[model samples]
Target: MHDTKVTTDVMNPDCIVIGYNEIDFAEHARRKRAEKGKSGGYHDLLTNSVLLGGERRTYMDLLNIVRERTTGCPSRLSAFELPSLGVAYLTSFLRRRGFSAAPVNSFNSATEQLREMLAGSPRAVAITTTYYVYDEPIQQIVRFVREQNPDVPIIVGGPRIQNLCSDQSPESRDGRLRPLGADIYINSTQGEDTLAAVLAALRDKGGDLSRTPNLIYRDPAAPDGPMLHTLTTVENNDLDENAVDWSYFDPSYYAPTAYMRTSRSCSFGCAFCNYPALAGPLNLSDLSTIEKELRYLCDHGVRNLIFVDDTFNVPLPRFKKICRMMIENKFDLKWISFFRCSNADDEAFDLMAEAGCTAVFLGIESGDQRILKNMTKFAKTDRYEYGIRELTRRGIATLASIIVGFPGETEESVKNTVAFLNRTQPTFYNVMLYYHDVLAPIENQREKYGIVGSGYAWRHSTMSWQEATDWKDYLVRNVNGPALMPGYGLSLWTLPYLLANGMTMEETVEFIKGASRLVIKGLDTDYLDPEPEIEEILRGLAAVRDGAGQGASS
Candidate 1:
């Protein structure tokens, strides 16, 4: 379905928000990916060799691994895919403030009608960014906006443009701003109020940006251009306190799935991730607020729901209560969400199943106990295994999300992971390589781990970036299950469409196994057909990895 919901105040929207550089899998891209699926074994290896640099690995080492049919290599086609929830969250808030907000989805999507929208003279344009991967597309979008409507104020936010830069000196931060040319660089995670205020002020034209809070902006009077302006840092402790209006987009315009979060921020301070720092602290929504939201979505014909909470089952008692509410209310919805192995209890899983939880994505970061410890997962590998086994037994499909290539990762640690995967064998597996974040928990103790550098481009004590990537490739092939390539994994927006339409986990695995290509669009989450619940997609991947490892040994 095309996104053609023309807003009433479209010509002069209080704000026109744009999200750019998303991987748009059209008919042609899918057809091309399907064709590459034909090459099978050679294609997998070649993809890995081409995508992963040959730094630490010798030419022969690379050649040998390629010959063995590595399972997890994300052919050169792999890239980062950001969740679209950010823009939705911002727009919902803007509307709550009684300001008109329209979304321009991507650079391509926006470029098509941006000039037309610009003609409408939006009070301001806000663009939310995610990973650094979107920098190129963001630059283009910003340049185009400036050229088309130079006077219209531009506001930018999201993880990629937050606190880390907010703390830097003006020249340093301006260095980043010089490329994008955004009028206002919003850098805090407590965005709802911050963004709404900016749009409200922009609507009044003479409002002081410096008075708004936690921003790096071009002061019109400043010589070097942008300067940091800090008001009280926004700390909206009440997670579910505000009214988040999701009425901006038509329900049918998106994929069948409707995603919600009962909480904001994560309490667990995993060293490798920067989310906790951004989110501030773990906080939950009042059950009443949740019921209201869920009932609203259901009333609007959104039955396939997913919670995008970093840890859906945390604050165990609250999660259980919500489940009961869903059951008692007879909420006609089937759902999927992320869960932590430590929090997966018998009652929780039972309530989830009864509440129509067909699937869960668990962050099973590593199989090695030491690696798990280093990652601060806290829970033992056995706990992870138990959670997986329990979920599967309850007829709940599980996708264990793994991140390989931590600072201290090694061959033996990966072997431990392989064994863990073989034992648990999740319905599907998603493996992503560890990337560096100087502001994350890992960077806090960089010297302890011998980490040096800004981004994932760092010097670790024991493992080179190349070596870490090699191990990641090893895990994907070694981990038993239908391992999804990086940036191409399933997303909340599409998960419900797949499940509600009868795309069983088994069929998804087989489709993945048979294709054997670098799938960026993720196993066609849009298409669906009925099949059995259980299958061995990971089994084949594990076998290939095992045979390859054995061949190399001999």
Candidate 2:
């Protein structure tokens, strides 16, 4: 890590914030190992991953790889998109403030452009690391930046720092960010409003941090130690006001569909969730502003939209108003939204489809009542059935996001959930393996949830990783096969493009199920190199997902 230096005015004092991600097989395998808090030989990780079998590259991806190889040529098997909407707003706010700010948007763009931008030696380089797999790679990037330009203020933000703040002390916050090389840690509030204040502070010679909240400063006097500066709470709710520099983003950089968020946070206090801890509570964007955005997207020939709301169906009035507006405007755009079963009445689902929704994603955490109650999910399997079935009956495709290994999950619970899936047959399903965050309510209620172990090694009261993995494997083989959407189980993220381009809902689901999706993001440089070994690894995992091989633990 580099020594902390206060912001100095060396002229224009620009900031180039970048984000680095990995979808390459080797890089992805390394990240998976890091996430498990385990380290071993590279080949060993690949072998173990094939045996243990987490959600990975879809079966069709492997088939495509093999087919291309036989033709004596290779191409990129897939593409991954990390839209980094947070970074967009942050940099946009800086630009609007008269500071020279550049957003190196995508992972691919960062890799190719960051070094050059750094060579110019901007006043500061800012970036966001949003996921567990991103931490190490981002750390390496930050370290490299420090080596080249020791004086520049490196601002880092995102969930990793927030997770580190669980220690609940200023010194701990200081200590936690040392591993990362950021000069200022935006650990508290991530609103563009908050970041703009921080940026303005840093640009001033004295480095005024008075207006910032949840900020950890690097005091050169302390060097290795941090001086956590706690400021009064600031409501950074102007999220919808910030506009992205569309010139920085090329539609071709990501999937065919356009993405936007209508709001932040969910009202629910589900034990297993980290949403409230991260984003606080629901902060809806102005409905009038959203309508203008919808019209703009429509004017631009944008045909597919994805609503990234934490709970798009909640707060029934705003939800209904948005739906009514979409209907009134008669947007030709086909869209998909994340919905909770509690607010999913038949009338809502029916109105949603008439308003241009082609698919609805439901977070059906489990089919077992006990597991649902264990997490304070508030909604039960019967409720999931009604909402999902209503969408299915209404010709609106449904995708159920399922999770295994909740604190009280059991063999019977797995069996019951699988039975429920078999009976309902939602258009598709997203099977997630549970990982506990230190800040989540569930972690605090260890006894309440029967959580065992501690930190990264923890497990639920009755469930072991091996047991959960095996059960997850069983569910894939029996319940999910052949029901997935084609071409990477792109799910709602890319399904609108597929539908708009001509694929039917049934055709889309066919691609999503039966496929073990590759977890990392992919790029367009992107031509798949025919790695028969990679294909063979995928085939081996497919056999296990198809119930042919014993899991890694066995």
Candidate 3:
């Protein structure tokens, strides 16, 4: 742990950005029970199981908890991983510009912390808010800064703010939907432009805000309460390498490895996702620029790199270019990134594996074609299976993501998902409870998929759109079988992967056989009542057994 530097009445820094960091994992556990209508005891049981079970905690459960809590209860809180990336990038970007910037987690004493930072007579403050849980804290932070130093400019950005800004136009009231507290609202796409403009303005003691992209502000002296600016959208490869200052920002804040975003935005517009809306179309940074960035990290001793791109494998040619550059440079680093299952092919998989790609997180979405089509995933079940198997055969590990409780989800659909996952057998999986956003732009045209009730209130304990669907019962009834939903079951499946990865080949096979048998037998007898159907399916998993058995036999 890095020791906190204590300074008495320290001069206010130039800028302070508040990032809502991860609270303890227990709070999320409690939220899950609240959303599921499970008893209080259930929370303790889960917390105990995860905290005490040690090796028993599965990736599926972690993802499920994230989805259920973020969806069912409209809190701005998110899993610790994503926000850490955003903070690292932003902090690094700011420090490179010669600005004293530090990313502070919201778990600390926020008010006092702000007061301490502002003591330096800083020029401005920026804070991030996600869709579900951050509105209130961000608003409060804005208000606190305003009350303390009325002239200090405050900027807000994140998925929630970006969506709100994107929906705003001459004819729409979406801009007004945002809390009136912020001096500026920035969309996600123009993060660098907006931050740079804000920094420039602060240095000059304020200037015309019109030049800033993806910003909205209010001038009390003018009749119009607020004015919005044209947002700047950069090309995929247009990242400003010189704009980032690395001195004040620390890369050591991350675990496993440092995080980097090789590209911005997503090409696919899955109806349930907000990325296309918030990020505004797919864009890739130039391969040379990405190579430069990767080399910089490697030179700086960053051995693990996690690309934060929503769809890393899209624009197959560009992806191949990146792979080639990585291999050519001999960038001795291991990386993990997300990919659309439909877009990956044998060549791409081979290149990635050769370049030391450790894992690829695939957004498999759902196993049912109808549900997938409804979600606009645009890929068939067969394609997904082929991709997973190919990746596995090539010795590159895979993490499949699945969504459950979507509008068209049914008992049969959930079962099919589990069966599909069982057949493909990725090394790891993540199951997300469905989250319906009525506030999303397409909600009016897609009301059937829109979440009902007062939608989720960010940062507050309230019912979210997914909760309106009675998802717990739906999941319990429809996805209750022994085979986990392709997405949901991955959590539990990862435990064996983790154990196996740490062992020798022979030991790994033995571990898998013993675990698989125990799991199969548990499923067979009705002893594990919650997953009986899964047990029945396991009885038919002779192929899976043979695969595991062969490795052991060899």
lDDT scores in order: 0.64, 0.62, 0.56
| Runs with alpha carbons beyond 4 Å of true place in candidate 1 | 2-7, 23-83, 105-107, 110-113, 131-134, 163-167, 205-207, 221-232, 489-493, 499-504, 515-554
TM-score of each: 0.79, 0.79, 0.67
Stretch of 10 with least lDDT, candidate 1: 50-59
> Which 10 consecutive residues of model 2 have the lowest summed lDDT?
1-10
Which residue runs of candidate 3 sit more than 4 Å off their true CA positions?
1-11, 24-83, 95-98, 105-116, 130-153, 165-184, 205-237, 240-256, 439-554
Residue-level lDDT tens digits of model 1 in 1-554: 32334344677888887765543333223343454433222222222221212121111232223323334453221111122565666666777668887766445544666788897678898887754443555676788888888888888877777744745776777787667777887777766678887876676757577678767777777736447566758658355656455556776533356557788888798888878877777878889999998887787777677788888788888889999999999986888888887986898878998999988888888889999889888888888988999888999877777766687888888788878888888776656656676767787778898876654445577776666556666666555455442233233234565555544454444544433232321222333221111123344445655666798899
Q: For model 1, what is the error of residue 121's alpha carbon versus the real structure, in angstroms, after optimal superposition?
A: 1.5
True-vs-predicted CA distance for residue 119, candidate 2, Å = 2.8
Steric collisions counted per model:
5, 21, 27
Q: For model 1, what is the C-alpha lDDT against the true structure? A: 0.64
- Compared with the true structure, the alpha-carbon lDDT of candidate 2 equals 0.62
Name the lDDT of candidate 3: 0.56
Candidate 1 TM-score, true structure as reference: 0.79
